[model samples]
Target: MIMMDEIVLFNPGDSIGNFHDYHEAVQTAQIYQERHTESGHVVVVKSDNGAPSFDIFLAEQQLDNGQKNPSTSKRYTISKKL
Candidate 1:
């Protein structure tokens, strides 16, 4: 039997953070996306031994000044993994 480890990497363009759990990393990424206008992403990698890992990419939209014209802020989840 073989065991595979899952690694989650949070990329906010300029910096990167690592997480052991997928949901926690995604949650943190969402928080960052809501707090800043800059675009950010999360990558999940699953691997075993020294073999190449499979990656899943998720990204958030970049908010602009014009999009904030409304009185209330909009909250939604926008992510795609491949």
Candidate 2:
């Protein structure tokens, strides 16, 4: 299983597809997962420590205004919208 901590950020949109942001991105991936799952297919792969890799745990919708930039504050939580 790919470690969310490692790094993975592959946008579902392909070269022929249009651009999409975080929310759209997640929805798209989930949609694909649902389809594959319904078809009795399992898509499991390893995450890479590169641009195409991101922490899903961290990727989850979490507002973090309290979490200041490392350049500004050292330790703090983000003021995310509930």
Candidate 3:
């Protein structure tokens, strides 16, 4: 399988966007955060490191009836404040 690194803008049940470029994703996340004060958002990066991507987690959660198991995929959050 081909592994492509990606940045995903996540908000629990909703996903804002996915970006291949880090800077663009960060800028977009920051802008979204600035516009939505009460909403919680996080910027997640897909990497080789052993962490679950927010997007993948969401999909898995849906299949598992809201259960979370981190060992299934690889991703890490860059910023929860952005």
Candidate 4:
């Protein structure tokens, strides 16, 4: 298998967009999430080995239980630089 970092934008209807650049993927996700506020889309960034580095979600959602609440989405940061 080819080894490289990956970014995926998970949109409504379980549709996904694959990307190699994390920032680009995140931007796309943000745009989609903003445009489709009712869709509840999310973004995932992974390392070369498939370990998740970042999980971006719609606002007012919980990361632990995958539940929606009034709190902002939780963010995980592996490093200062992407």
Candidate 5:
């Protein structure tokens, strides 16, 4: 088992792209989120076989009246092919 750092960018519709560099992965995620006006995140996994890769979801911002609005957040993952 080889240990490595993997970066994953999650896009809308459950699409994902894997990156070897953390900076590139985060940059890509930010660009995509800004363009789509949605919430997304970049995750780093360190381990052998890269077990337990997942998405970081942010909840919708609350209104002034303390009401939770719907979030446009989406889930992303790293592809095994990477």
Candidate 6:
């Protein structure tokens, strides 16, 4: 399993643009999915490395009961440093 540190940090409601390579795209996707695997107050993943990836809304759940609230579709846009 890939470690959390290895996965790039993403936020909700971010926009993604063109991707440079397929590996970057795949990595972004993997991290996006991982963020949703857990319950309760999850953060969406976004990559601005110009990598093609999916944008999923992370829903926050009750810490004690694990009940998730309605997920708000937040856009995540990642940017690269030129």
Question: If both were scored by lDDT, which would come out higher, candidate 4 or candidate 6?
Answer: 4
Error of 6 at 60 (Å): 20
lDDT of candidate model 2 versus the reference: 0.29
> Could you give candidate 5's per-residue lDDT for residues 1-82 as a string of tens digits?
9965343322233334445665565566566566756453333322123543333222222122322432432223332221
Q: What TM-score does structure 6 among the candidates reach?
A: 0.25
User: What are the runs in model 4 whose C-alpha is more than 4 Å off?
Assistant: 1-15, 47-82
For model 3, how does the per-residue alpha-carbon lDDT over 1-82 read when each residue is reduced to its tens digit? Answer: 9955443332343356655666666667677667776665444444334443322222212222233643442334443334
Q: Rate the local accuracy (lDDT) of all candidates.
A: 0.39, 0.29, 0.44, 0.44, 0.37, 0.37
**Per-model TM-score versus the true fold:** 0.34, 0.28, 0.44, 0.39, 0.34, 0.25
Which TM-score value belongs to model 4? 0.39
Candidates 2 and 3 compared: the better one by lDDT is: 3
**lDDT at 5, model 5:** 39
lDDT of 6 by residue, 1-82 (tens): 8734323333333333224464565455456556645533333334444555444333331122222432432233422211
RMSD versus native structure for model 5: 11.0
Question: 2 or 6: which has the higher TM-score?
Answer: 2
Q: What is the lDDT of residue 77 in candidate 1?
A: 27
How far off is residue 28 in model 6, in Å? 0.6
Task: Tell me the lDDT of model 6 at 67.
Answer: 20
> Tens digits of per-residue lDDT for model 1 on 1-82?
9954422332233233344555665566556556653554443433332443232334333333465343332222223232
> For every model in order, what is the number of clashing pairs?
0, 15, 1, 0, 0, 13
How would you encode candidate 4's per-residue C-alpha lDDT over 27-65 as one tens digit per residue? Answer: 777777678778663544343345444334443332444
RMSD of each: 13.8, 14.3, 9.4, 10.4, 11.0, 12.4
